[model samples]
Target: MGRIGNIINRKGKQDAKRASVFTKHARAITVAAKEGGADPEYNAALKTTIDKAKADNMPNDNIKRAIDKGAGAGGGEDYFSNTYEGYGPGGVAVIVETLTDNKNRTAGNIRYYFDKNGGNLGTTGCVGFMFDRKGQILIAAENVSEEQLMDDALEAGADDIITEEDGFEVVTAPEDFNAVRDALVEKGYEFVSADIKLIPQTTTVLDNEGQVKAMEKLIDLLEDDDDVQNVYHNWEITE
Candidate 1:
């Protein structure tokens, strides 16, 4: 499995953190709806965001309210999507995605987290070039046969499919993501996790224990912040 897959799996098991997870998803949904339209049928981005939120078991009511809030059916704060690039411990490339009404507060918090953990935030695109944006869909191995999935996924326009011990990872180009995912869904396939993600081209490994601890802390702090939606890093975490 990819590093992002591992992170998703770990987060999925953290039932205690469900509230925070939902908050992030909700924020993303609102942003997608506001940028595009609230109607998922007319808005591809909103549709994809809704699918992901549902996969995470976000409440239907919460999803509706988020859409309504974004559509201006109800009054809500205007949220701006921001991306921050940085180097974590051991020169690991990191990208942080956030949705916030207050950019200054979010920027300060992100910079502080990086500095406190032996990392330094950098200008936009500083570490972004180290990654590629793609759509990644993970499905449990027990849910489908490898042969069947391979045929279906390829026919649906996926770029590649990787079989992992616990699941299958279906990859698609950014432009083809919505079509491929929707096609698979129409065929009755369910995903364990599905979303557009930044896949790192090369990874960095921290040999020093202190660096590893700092990196882990940095990630935890970023994820815990309500403003942060996603954090991508080229840190090769091993068991």
Candidate 2:
């Protein structure tokens, strides 16, 4: 199959990925609620954080129970979020964000994956400069005009907004995420997902083989680790 054909077929893999991604995000929400306030009304970040979870089909009971558990005694100690910087195959900068209580175990496994997969695990701040943390909001594209979308997003404190073929990517500061999400929600926008994400400052172009193989290896290593919450890389991909 050609590259585009392979990408078309990979839609199934994305569905599989959702299951793993939701599990990781669930842990993140539990941790966030524990550290901050459990009440989503008071904790704006946690509110949007859980919103993304629910957007992905996470059960309402699980969401409510996570908040209760997060506020309960002895909950925060089981999870902590951290970001690891590294260089992947072809010198691609990769950042792995994780929520794990056992930092030692997570670190050891991550380092091993990098070493074994033609990558190098760098020290803190090594490749971190390659990325910037931002608020990312995605809303359904149906019947939404770019001009109206831009106006609404900017009014909601978004730094910039781009309308994609399938949806809109609204960008904002880490602090402004909740406000943007709330504004969009009140406007009756149908959002697929809304959360804080890290965007690569720059991206590296890769061949089709490089893209598939590198992602396959990275995904395999990541899904095996219970501590990994999210992984971000600068490898530029296309259909």
Q: Candidate 2, residues 1-239: lDDT per residue as tens digits?
A: 33223333443455567767666767877877887888888887677778778766778877777777788843445776788999888788888988887899899999888888778889899988888999877765668888888998899899998766666788999988888888988997876556687889888866668646866697578765768877788877654
Go through the candidates in order and give each one's C-alpha lDDT: 0.88, 0.77
| Best-fitting candidate, scored by lDDT | 1
Query: Residue 50 error for model 1, in Å?
Result: 1.3
Q: Model 2: runs farther than 4 Å from truth?
A: 1-19, 73-77, 208-211
RMSD of 1: 1.9
* Cα RMSD, each candidate: 1.9, 3.5
| Model 2 residue pairs with clashes | none
- lDDT tens string, model 1, 40-151? 9999988888887787778999999999988888878888889999999989999999989999999999999999999999999899999999999888776599999999
Q: Which candidate is the best by TM-score?
A: 1
Question: How much does candidate 2 score in TM-score?
Answer: 0.85
